[model samples]
Structures are given as structure tokens and as C-alpha cells.
Target: MAWGRIQTADGRTLSGMLTDTGLQPMTGFGSTTPAGPVEALDGATLLAPCQPGKFIGLWNNYHAAAEKNGLAIPAAPLWFLKPDTSVVGHGATVTLPPQAGRVIFEGELGVVIGTPCRNASLAEAEAAIFGYTCINDLTSLDILNADPAFAQWSRAKGFDGFGVIGPSIATGLDWRDLTIRTLVNGRERQSYPASDMIFSPAEIVQHLSQDMTLMPGDVIAVGTSLGVRPVKAGDVVAVEIDGIGSAEVTLA
Candidate 1:
């Protein structure tokens, strides 16, 4: 089943299970049964699939990107946090901040946690996963490397509306068979297979759980492959995963 949030015609925000024709309002978070009438998705506004408390994006997690960038493979995942305020759902218009130089879009697969866990084992981590979604981890490249002493990972990527995810959270998604793609203004810019990841989704969760408590809706972006370029003010950037869906944002 696919889950998503939306703003109804009445201006109320609700969570629901998404069907091809419409949305069935969920009983509550994580529930499978419907509690209200089916809603016509076209008349409602879609939101980020879930309200994530933390957004962690990985780096060097893809073998293809690692090799292309001439970076050595690391034993553990390298990640950075994007503030919750930066997150936006599909169809959002993202404003480019002043002095935010050369922003690029990263198309990735996102793992959404379903259960709270700390130091979870592989099996536990696998079980804790709720669903998967696509993520667009936009970064301000020039600002990231500008400082000599420290890398501005957060600032470079944590600008408002930079952490884009969701059209819906797809349950039972097979990472091995998935493909991620990014488009800028309707033209495909990046495309890669999910099979290229050095760390599987479950392994990433297990490792991350060892360091911090992961709660339901917390997102771990599995990282991106090559083919990233700067996005301009008028561009419409979109990240799409074969099994999940697209998270699109218009830059302004």
C-alpha cells in the first residue's frame, strides 16, 4: 500500500492510503484501514508522505558515484542532517536564497522508519522500515566547499525546501529492482539503479540506529549516483524512483 498526506478541500490535513483513483483516509498513522470516504486526489493538495523528525542524507553510498568522484570506499556511512524546516513535499515552489551559490539536485531513494529503535540489529532494522520514497537532496555546492576549515554540509543543503521527498510512501518496494531519476525542467538529468548502492537500505538503518534513536517517519536518503548539475531559479527539479514516486519542486 502507498501512504500519503494531503490538504483536503475543507483545508484539513489528513493522512491516507493512496490508490490509483483516489485516497482512502487512514484511521491514523500506520493504520491500514480506512476511516473516511475516498477523496479525489486531484482536488486535494499533496504533502510530504510523512512528517519526519530527522532527515539524514548519506554520501559515498553509491559505488558508481564513489568511483566517478575518485573517492575511497568507507567502512561506514557518511551523512549529514537537514533540518525539518527544509523539508517540502511534491509541487512545492522553492525559493533560492541569496548568496546560496550553485545549488545541485541529488536524486535518491529514501527509507522511512516505521518503528522506534536504538542500536537495532539487521533483522530489527528491516522490520522497523515502514516504506520507501524518493528524495531530492538539493545542495549549494559552492558554499559547501567555500570555507577552508569546515564543510558547511548543513547550511549548503538545509536551506528551506531543500529536503524534498514524497508523492507517497510505497510499502513493499524492492530496492534491487528500482531505478532513480532526476529531471530539470522536464528534461532527464540523472538516472541510476538502486542496485548501485554500496549499503543496502536495511544495513543503513541498522548502522544509523546504533548511533541514534530512529523514530517512525525518520528518513535516511540512500544517496545518489552521478549526473548532478546546478539548478536555476526557473527550473522545475524532480526526483523519481520507479517503485515509489516523484518529489518535484519548482525553483523560484
Candidate 2:
């Protein structure tokens, strides 16, 4: 099953269907059966799939990309956090805020938390998962790697619309065997298999739970591989993971 949050023509927001066919309202994101009203897709627009309390992301998780950047494979998973407001929905335009310089696009696999968990073991972590989705973790690289006095990831990556997720969340996709890709202007800039991940999704969750509580709706971006590239205004950025679907956004 797929889950999404959409906007209605009347400006009302609610969770619903997210497919090429269009939006369909349901009781909630956790609704099991798809027996809901066939509200006009135009009645609502898509919103970021979930309103997460914590948005955790990973770095150096992909082996190929780490090697390309002349970096060693991490001894352990490196994780970071982006502000909740960074999220935007599919088909939304990402405004390159004036303060940002040298913005880049990172296509990644996103894991959505289904239940609350803390200090979970690998076995327990496996049960905490809810689903998966696509992530376009747009970054302001200059600001991200700036001076030692001001190198704060929260400011560099927390800009509104900097984190783009959706089309929809796949509830039962096998994450270990997916192709993650990023395309800019019809050109394939990045492509790697999920097998390239240095750490498994369950490991990421288990590690994260040691330090923070994983709550329902919290997202863990599995990190990107070597295909990260710069983008400018008017360019279209797309991230697709086979079986999960694609998420496209325009730079504005």
C-alpha cells in the first residue's frame, strides 16, 4: 500500500492516495483497507508524505560514492539531522534561497519509521519499520562546508524545501534490492544499487535508536552514492528507486 498527504482545491490537507491515477482520500496514513471516497485529485494537492518530528539523514553510507570522494569507508554509520520544515512534496518547486550558494542534489532511499522505539536491538529495530520512500536531499554545499566557526549542518541543510520526499511511501517494498538514481535535465547523473550501502537499514535503525527515540513518521534517509551534482534555478531534479516510484522537483 502507498501513503501520502495531499492538498485539496479548497486548501484542506489530508492523507490520501499517491499514484499516476491521482489522489484518493482515506481515513489516515495508517489506514489498512483502501476503501475511501474517490475525491477528485484536483480537490487536493500533494503535501510532504509525513510530518516528522525528527528527520535523520546519513552520510558516507554508500561505498562507491565514498571511494570516489577519496574518503575511507566509515567505521560506523554517520548520521545528521535536517529541520522538519525542509520537507516538501512531489511536483513542488524548490526555491533556491538567496542566502544559499552552490546548492546540490542528493538522491537517496528514505526509510519511514512505523512505531516508537528506543535503544532497540537489531531484531527489535526490524519491527519498528513502517515503509520506504524516495528522498531528494538538496543541500547548500558552500554553507555546509564553510568555515569552522560556522559549519552548522542545521543551517546549511535545514532550509525549507531542502528535503523533498514522496510521490508516495511503499509499505511493503524489499529495500535491499532497489536501484537508486538521480537525473538532471534528462541526463543520468547518478546510479547505484542498494547493495552499495555500507550499512543495512536495520543497522541504521538500531544505531539511531541508541541515541534517539524513533517515532512513527520519523524518516531516515539512507544516504546517496557518487551521483550528487550541483543544480541551478530552472533545472529539474529527479530521484527514483525501482518499486518505490519517483520524486521530481524544479529549482526555482
Candidate 3:
């Protein structure tokens, strides 16, 4: 089933299952209790599928991108955190910071946590996973490489509205067979297979869980592959996954 958060006309955000007919409100995320009547999709506004307490992003997780850039396969997942304020829902506008030069869009798969986990085994970590969603990990390239002394990874990617995710989180997906594609202003820029990942989702969760506890609604961006490029103002960026729906954000 596909899960999402929708904002009704009354300004209440509800967790629900996205159905062909509309949204069936749930008591909570992964909740068995039904909340209220179905809200038609057209009448409500979609929010980021989930509000992740921790927004973790991986780097150099794809074999193809590593090979192309002559980057060594990391012994572990190289990760960074984006502040919660960076998150924006699909159809939201991503305003570029005035001093932030040359921003780029990275399309990646997002792993949504369902249960709290710490030092979890692979099976436990897998079970803790709620579903997967599409993420556009927008980065300010100029700010990132501005000072070679220290890589400002978080600052570069943690700007307001930089973390764009959702249309919905899809459960029961065969992630291995999925592909991630990114488009800029209607033109394809990135296309890669999830099979190219150096560290699978389960491994990432299990390993990261050993270091920090992952709570429900935490998101782990599996990272991007080749063909990442810059985007300017007015460009509409879309991240599409085969099973998960597309998430689009317009640059302003």
C-alpha cells in the first residue's frame, strides 16, 4: 500500500493510505486504526510523505558512479544529515539561497523507518523499514567545494527546501528491480538502477543503527548515481522511482 500525508482544507495534516479513490485517513503512521472519511486527492494538498526526525543521506553508494568518478568503494556507508527544515513536499518550491551558487539536483531512493532501532541485526533492520519514497537531494555545489579545508556537506545540502521527497511511500516494493530517474525541466538527466548500489538498504540500516538509534519516520537517502548536474531558477526537478511515485520541486 502507498502511504502519504495530506493537508485538508481545514489545515489539518493526516496520515493516510493513498488509494485510487482518495486518501483513507489512518490514526497514525503504520496504524491499524482508521481515522476519518476518505479525502479526495484533488481537494487536499500532499505533504512530504513522512516527517523524518533524522534525515540521513549516503554518499558514494553506487558502483557505476564510483567507477565513473574513480572513487574507491567505501568500506562503509559515507553519510550526512540534513536538518528537518530542509524538507519540502512534492509540488513545493525550492527557493535558492541568494549567496548559494550553482545548485544541483540528485535523484535518490529514500528508506523510511517504521520502528525504533538500535544496533539492529539485518533482519531486524529490514523489518523496521516502513517503505520507500523518492528523494531529490538538492546540493549547493559551490558552497560544498568553496573551502577545501572543510567540506560543508550539511550546510551545502541542508538549506531550506533542499530535501524534496514524496508523492507517497510505497510498501512491498521489490527495490532490487527498481530504477531511479531524474529530470530537469522535462529533460532526463539521471537514470540508474538500484542494483548498482554498493551497500543495500538493509546493510545501511543495520550498520547505521549500530551508531545511532533510528526512530520511526527517520529517512535514509540511498544516494544518487551518475548524471548529476546543475539547475537554475525556474527549473522543475523531478525524481522518479519505478515503484515509488514521482516527486517534483520547482526551483525559485
Each candidate: how many clashes? 0, 5, 0
In lDDT terms, how accurate is model 2?
0.85
> Runs in model 2 with CA error above 4 Å?
17-26, 33-36
Best by lDDT: 3
Taken over the whole model, the C-alpha lDDT of each candidate is 0.90, 0.85, 0.93
Which candidate achieves the best TM-score against the true structure? 3
Residue lDDT tens for model 1, 140-183: 99899999899999999999999998989999878899999999
Model 3, 1-252: lDDT tens per residue?
999988987888888898876888998887757898888887788999999999999999999999999999999999999999999999999899987899999999999999999999999999999999999999999999999999999999999999998989999997899999999989999999999999999999999999999998999999999999999999999999877889999999
Candidate 3 lDDT score relative to the true structure: 0.93
Residue 158 lDDT (model 2): 89
User: What does candidate 2's lDDT look like per residue over 23-110, in tens digits?
Assistant: 5666655565565666566656767788888999898898888888888988778888999989998889889998889999999999
Q: In model 1, what is the error at residue 5, expressed in angstroms?
A: 0.6
